[model samples]
Target: MEEVAVASDGRALTVGSQQLAHSLFANYPLTAAFLSFALAQTLKVLTTWYKERRWDAKRLLGSGGMPSSHSAAVSALAVAIGFHDGPGSSSFAIALVLACVVMYDAFGVRLHAGRQAEVLNQIVFELPAEHPLADTRPLREPLGHTPPQVAAGAALGLIMAYLMHVTTNLSS
Candidate 1:
């Protein structure tokens, strides 16, 4: 079978390797998700190292990092959809709405919940030592997005989308 080669940020791959170009194009959104998640994890690790001068394993699994990974993924998808489907298209509109809801939840509702959890955990810790199950550890809830965190995530997502467009010659 003949394959058409396309060059990306240094990588070369054959086009039309999949059932359809659309299927292959859909990878943009998926890549955005993975990139966001990895970036968030990396940020947490880097932040921990900066603060304590050590690589803390726990930071890798912790939430509420410098940039909100959740924001990055959603914003990336939204931006991709807008680019692919046209900003006025129904698909883009839906994605935009979903992104707004997700960001709001991360910054507003979920953040509050995490703070509440922290308070609850503190209270639990202060309980009398004689009580049943007194040895149980307090719950740690991580929440809230600092403005800088959200901005960083948004910038990351937008940059990724733009880079994909430029490198892939993707219309978006």
Candidate 2:
């Protein structure tokens, strides 16, 4: 049996005599998931610039936007796996469940946490200067996605994964 090593970055699997390596785009599911994530982040930047009339590069790496990047990525991963491995396969089932869990958490638990943070921050800001906790930094309030945000992200993910699947699989 050949001893093989999986790359830490998951870009390739290496055999003793040769290296099988390629760009991220070469892998259908991986590419779909990653590109979906990047596209969602880029969209956040654009939406911020349009709505706020300011360019906020930080949105590219931040959470909570018109579309949830977390939802986009996981949904794309699930769909892509379904396409590549067949919807009835174990891999596809795992991916689909993971996507559902992530999206649900984004809409429910995380959203509540962000809202709570906003309230706490307001309370802190109203505290008297002499209070012991008055100087605490405001919490990060944009930590989750609303229902519409999660829906949009899931739609984007489905489209992106379909496109990636077609292009990658058909062309090969």
Candidate 3:
């Protein structure tokens, strides 16, 4: 059975557990990343709701928010790998490098692409109704993650990894 630990704020950590739930509980790093991404999407929906005072199904799929989900997930995975495999481990190194690349793309290339899409969408929206381009709709390309979003994700992942490691150690 894996040992479970709780933080002052009630967060949990575990190394490994025989029970399915407990075993799954140990994988907090990955879960945290996903939760962060979900939070960003939810925020976008809320923002839209506030502006329009109405529900927008499109916001659910819209990208770009306080934190980048992609960055969060990959960074969390890297942090988890680092914790599990050791900083110097080849697996951890690979994961860390991959995470960096992913974050860079999300904040740099993908972000610019989103901006380009936005400008293009604006142009499309301004087209005259009688123009053939009037039928072209704006694509919902995401603005990707910001540097702070990526950094926050990295922090969250590291914290989760550490907590998991500590709990596993204490439980044993």
Candidate 4:
């Protein structure tokens, strides 16, 4: 039940669909951000497999892994915004702030929480057999990225955004 509308540039866009959803994808910044996130998650899976010598499909949707997907997503968004809208634009400023917040949280609060979880998990393991909490499952670790991981993710995001911009220009 959707109608198609031709853009001024001759690109056909679906209308009366999700109302603005298609338009969002048509925006290069949004597309770059999403692609960066996908690539980061995919890299996480590959990194895990390489390190552990086992494939962990769950990593695709998991958080707190190396090269922080959160960092990658926000950084890519910021970079893309800077590219699409000039760096002096308010949109770019907002995106940069958001990216900084996300990266900080990944390296600060989340990292501390992960460490706390590890300690609690160790405590539970050392508990006496009669302790009721001893039977509880261990907490999920790797809830945040190290500084290096955040840096790597941010670098990846910036690179991907630039690459996307270049590729889109070439295609156009």
Which pairs clash inside model 4? none
**Candidate 1 residue runs with Cα over 4 Å from true position:** 1-26, 170-172
Q: Candidate 2 — what's its lDDT?
A: 0.89
What's the residue-level lDDT of 37 in candidate 2? 95
Candidate 4's clash total is 0
Give candidate 2's error at residue 170 in angstroms. 3.2
For 40-93, candidate 2 gives per-residue lDDT tens digits of 999999989899999999999899997899999999999999988899989899
TM per prediction: 0.76, 0.89, 0.68, 0.87
Residues 1-172, model 3: lDDT tens digits? 6777675469986645465465455565555556555655565577667877987777666667645656666776777777776889887788889988988988898888988898999998988999998899687677776788677656655665566667767887
lDDT (tens digit, per residue) of candidate 1 on 1-172: 4366655456766656563455554577667666776777688788878988998777666777667777787788788777666889887788789878877887788788888988888777888999775677766687767667777877777777667656656463
Clashing pairs in 3: 2-16, 2-17
Q: Name the candidate that leads on TM-score.
A: 2
Cα deviation of 56, candidate 1, in Å: 2.5
Model 3's alpha-carbon lDDT is 0.70
Enumerate clash totals for all models, in the order shown.
0, 0, 2, 0
Q: Give the TM-score of candidate 3.
A: 0.68
After superposition of all CA atoms, the RMSD between model 1 and the true structure is: 7.1
Q: How many backbone clashes can be found in candidate 1?
A: 0
User: lDDT of each prediction vs. the true structure?
Assistant: 0.73, 0.89, 0.70, 0.88
Tell me the spans in candidate 3 whose CA falls farther than 4 Å from its real position: 1-61
